[model samples]
Target: MRRAAIVGTGAIAAAHAESLRALGDRVELVAVADVDGERAAAFAKEWGVPRAHPGLAELLRAERLDLVHVCTPPRHHVPIALDCLAADVHVLVEKPPALSLSEVDLLVEAERASAGRVATVFQHRFGPAAIRLRRMAAEGVLGRSLVAKCDTLWYRGDAYFEVPWRGTWDSEGGGPTMGHGIHQFDLLLSILGPWSEIRALAARQARAVQTEDVSMALVTFADGTVASVVNSLLSPRETSELRFDFERATVEVEHLYGYTDAHWAITPAPGHDDVAASWREKPSGVVSGHRWQLAAVLDALDSGEPPPVTLADTRITMEFIAALYASAFTGTVVKAGDIGPDDPFYKSMEGAGAPWADAR
Candidate 1:
């Protein structure tokens, strides 16, 4: 069995635990760790895990880990992942890999050096809606994609900021873009392809947090496909959706918990009844497939297949984030893929003092 250890025990960390337990006989939950000793012990007791480590180092020593899942906040991903890589353990980390694009580069380098795998949790990419939508797009049911959009209009109250790092530019990265909006947007880019350039406006409206709780962006892809993205944490009824409009059809992808079945409604464009008829004749589509994503990684471990999500894919997201920061900070559009090894963020933004304390 592929033995695994989880090194964080917070809310999302609990989700990791659930996914691991869901892995069942194919994987074993070897241990859990948290900086807070009591929390670690409590999690271990609750999950029936045989061991609990008060710190990450202790967990690594106790468990012969085949893979390690770094579920700590964004700030903790780099250190924990580096430790695992050095010990020759495969790693699966939560999204936005690190506080900044540069930090993720280090993990990428480690993955290369060890020739092992490290996956970012683009869990939304596994949601029911995402899987079906991707297949439809690939099969041209959407018929030459014309437009894509992502929205995360959600509400967060005063109690939401009760946590120390929620609103800050530091611990949690940008308020919604990195924290909440990254999910659907990642799915958008995954389906639509890398963007050519971005023009963005971010504001700290409707919340007493350091980062923008609401933001909007206009993106232009290399193929001239255009997209609009709006992300917020202050909406009354929160909804996350991504839609793709193609020359011949439009497909809407929707999901909840960022998991579960995502419905896809494919409608033919004004004069394309034939395309819709073909879909009706061949409607043997797939279901919302989060479990399938997990199965991919587990099967990779079993058969030595490379994980589907890779560092290059994550770099595209990071490059966009860096450009987003540049746009937000400079009040101008930023080109993707323009930042390179010589950029200020390349070597160490921390030492240079990043615009955001977290630099993401």
Candidate 2:
């Protein structure tokens, strides 16, 4: 059995522990580590993990682990992942993998030299409905994807930002665009292909944070499709939604956080009633969550293949995020491949800092 350890024991770490428990036979949960030693020990006891460490360095020195889950804060992701790669241990890092494109490139280079691979946690793409949608779209069952809408409108009050790192550009990476809505838009990118250009704007309307609480973008895909995206922390009726308007039908999923088949629906255009059958043919009952994704990661290790949400796949989404910020901050249209090593945005999501930095 493959041996695994989690590097953080926080709220999200519980999901990782539960998933590893679910895949109990295939993988062994050997140990855990956290900055708070007492919390780590408690988590280990609760999860039945064998050992606990005060930090990743201590855990690495004590264990011969096959995989490490980097569930730490945004700023720590790259450093912890670098340590894992140096030890040739595979990593399943949580979302917003790195704070900036520069940090992502650092992991990409480290991965190239390591015997193990890295995968980002983007569980939405693994759900049965999303899987079926991708298959249908690829088979031309959906016809040309004309337009799309991705919205992550979730409410987060001022108290939510009290968590020292919750609202900062350096620690949380960004506001809703980086922290919340990325899951929805990443699923959108998996359905549609590469995005070409983006024009966007961001504002700190509600939350008193260093980052923008609301942002909007108009995106143009490489295949000539256009989309509208919005990430906000001010909506009372919270929901995560993605809608794709293909020539044959419009496919959508609306859920607050995680989703099952019940959350998805399709409405076919006139003379395309057959589309419904294609959507229904796929087996259901799979919920999008860490468990589904962790299982896939283990399967890949068994087959000697890279896991889902590979670095290459994640960079596409990361580039889109950086471009969105670049567009919003500069008041100009930012395109794919527009930000390279020399561009300020390639090093920091805030680039030269947000336009409203002075106010903050």
- The TM-scores of all predictions, comma-separated, are 0.90, 0.99
Full-model lDDT for every candidate: 0.75, 0.92
Question: Ten residues in a row with the worst lDDT in model 1?
Answer: 348-357
Q: On residues 1-360, what C-alpha lDDT tens digit does candidate 2 reach at each position?
A: 999999989889999999999899899899999999999999999999999999999999999999999888888998999999999999999988999999899999999999988999999989889888999999999999999999999999888889998999889889999999999999999989899999999988978899989999999998889999999999999999999999999999899889999999999999999998788785578789999999999889999999888999999999999999999999999989999999999998899989989997
Please provide, for model 1 over 1-360, each residue's C-alpha lDDT reduced to its tens digit, 9 standing for 90 to 100: 789888898877777677778887888888989999898889889888888888888888878888887888777888888888888888888876777777878888887778458878787676555655667678877667788888888788989898887776568766778877887888889888879999977766667666777778999988789999988888888787777888988767555454443255667888898766655554433443334566677887788876756778888887777676666656677888766777654433222333343533
After superposition on all C-alphas, the RMSD of every candidate to the true structure, in Å, is: 3.3, 0.8
Q: Report the C-alpha displacement of residue 107, candidate 1, in angstroms.
A: 1.2
Model 1 segments more than 4 A misplaced: 259-262, 271-290, 342-360
Which candidate should be chosen as best, given lDDT against the real structure? Answer: 2
Highest TM-score scorer = 2
lDDT of 2 at 85: 94
